[model samples]
Target: MHIAAANREDDLQRLHEQITQTRLAILVTHNEQGLQATHLPVLLDPQQGAKGTLLGHLARANKQWQALAEGAEAMLVFAGADAYVSPGFYPSKLEEPRTVPTWNYVAVHAYGRAEVFHDAERLLDIVSRLSDRHEAGRATPWSVGDAPADYIASMLRAIVGFSLPIERLQGSRKLSQNRSAVDVEGVRAGLANSPDPLDNQLAALMRQP
Candidate 1:
């Protein structure tokens, strides 16, 4: 991603926080055939490596994993809040009459070398962690052990686990940072008042430094 200096996000903790908040990531890889993507619920192990490690799985039937055999690098994309920015939102636009509409959004990209672990024990551990991460927010959390042992084993066998130790992390928070203070406030107010929840989210992001 080509991130402008004003929109670049360099804080590691902030980037990881966004990763944790995102529900799913689009994992991208290049195979001998071509580029492929899979939407996956990935776990971030912040302490696992120099950067961090990603834990996720794909169904055994998924051919996307076959690309790993050729040692392909992987990229996981996490999308955040986004909204439409109307030129009318900027008071300066009224005077200049040259401004155009644009989209304001936030996204993170993680690059790494992926390793597949298509075994029972490792798969069990990965799935258990993933389950715990999601369940922690519930009033009554679920666990991998809640299911029948045989059933859990069968499910694990049907999926293949993988780990990507993130080598590089990039974050883009393209709010209206390039605009004037008055114009930025105008954009924020417009988005904050929008009926769309996502627009409110994008507006909320504008309040942060």
Candidate 2:
């Protein structure tokens, strides 16, 4: 979230869409035990408010929820395409030998107040959407009712659902935006030729104006 002005994305709609596409995010919080981080699939609902809100659930056994409260602030980090940028890939490195290795990536940070919900109805809605999103492309898509009704309800009772009302949105596109146009082009070409799928994806993002 420490974004330079040149790379910052201030558009709320675009940022929210990017969040929705992100399959996973790291939720960070502070507590008496110090910093605690949890990786989960979170959905950002723009319909809730102007700043949007994050919805997700955690296991009942997971103690991270105890630290989250109505007014407590937490950070949810969504990572997009990213890859290692070798100086060897930069065209300028060959001519001037001044370039150093760095990383090219895109990420968004949402800081907000968390509100934990235990209501069965809300939890049902949350779980249904989450399951549908993950199973969207599957040939044999699974639904909440695939399991026994009582079993599903019991399972839901064991987990905790929560919402983080985002108060701040920050984004960064570090796709060699600081490099010279010539260097960026070289990097983009190099990444496109990489064997790594993530590298190729990052190269595609770099093509954006």
Candidate 3:
């Protein structure tokens, strides 16, 4: 991602927060055929590597995993709240009429070497952890052990696990920080009143100090 200096998010903690908040990520890779992308929920292991490690799984039938080579690099994109910014929302637009529409969003890109594995034990552990992470907040949290032993084994056999040891992390948070104070306030007011919940969420983010 081409992030301007003003929009660049350099805080490692903030980047990690964004990744954890948005568990789903777009994993992209290239092969002889062409580029391919898969959306999956990724778990971060902050203690696993210098930066961090990402764990996720893909269906055994997915051709994307077949393209992975040892030490090959892949990118995982995690997106947070995003909304459209209208030119009318900028106070300067009424003064000079030079303002244009833009988008406000938060995103993080993680680059790492891809490693594919099919170990049943490792795959089961990955699945169990993933399940626990997502199900923790539920009133009736279901677990991998809730299913029959043979059923769980059958399910695990149909998927493959992978890990990506993060080598680089880049983040961008474009929330109208480049605009004038008046324009920023104008945007916040306009988005806050918008009917879309996502717009309201972005407005809240914009108001943060």
Candidate 4:
């Protein structure tokens, strides 16, 4: 990602939160065939400090998993929120028509080496963690153990479990950081007033000092 100086997020904790908050991420890889990507919901395991691993599963029929192996490098992208920033929103635009339109968004990039785990027990663990994390916030939480043993096992077989041990982490928070304070406020208000909840949430984030 081409993150401008004003938009860069260098704090590790901030970057980590962005990754953890996002449930879905795009996993990308490069090979002889060129670039390949897969969209998946992921769990970020922060046991290894900055070198955390991303856990997720791929359908057995998915060829993207086939291309990954132990130590295969991959990138995981976590998108926070985005909104269009009109030039009219910029306070400076009232003074002159010099500023161009832009976007306000945040994203985190994780680079890692993958190790595919096929063991039934490991699969069960991964699935359980994913389930628990997602259900933690729900009023009626569910669990992997709630279903029949055989049925859960059968379901697990239809997919493959893997972990990407992170090697590099980068983040960008382009929330009109390059704009003047007045323009920033304008963008925030524009996003906050949007119909999309995500845009509203993003605006709130941008409003943070």
Q: At residue 14, give the lDDT of candidate 1.
A: 91
lDDT of each: 0.92, 0.87, 0.90, 0.85
For model 3, residues 101-146, the per-residue Cα lDDT tens digits are 9999999999987789999999999999999999998999999999
Which ten-residue region of model 2 has the weakest summed lDDT?
64-73
Q: Against the true structure, what is each candidate's TM-score?
A: 0.96, 0.95, 0.95, 0.93
Residue lDDT tens for model 2, 24-110: 999998878688899999877898977988999988888888778534579899999999998887777767997779988888999
Which structure is stronger by lDDT: 1 or 2?
A: 1
Clashes per prediction?
0, 0, 0, 0
Ranking by TM-score: 1, 3, 2, 4
Give candidate 3's TM-score.
0.95
Question: How much is 113 displaced in model 2, in angstroms?
Answer: 0.9
Candidate 2 residues lying further than 4 Å off, grouped into runs, are none
RMSD of each: 1.2, 1.3, 1.2, 1.6
Measured on C-alpha atoms, candidate 1 has an lDDT of 0.92
lDDT, candidate 3, at 206: 91
lDDT of 2: 0.87
Superior candidate under lDDT, 1 versus 4: 1
Sorted on lDDT, best first, the list reads 1, 3, 2, 4
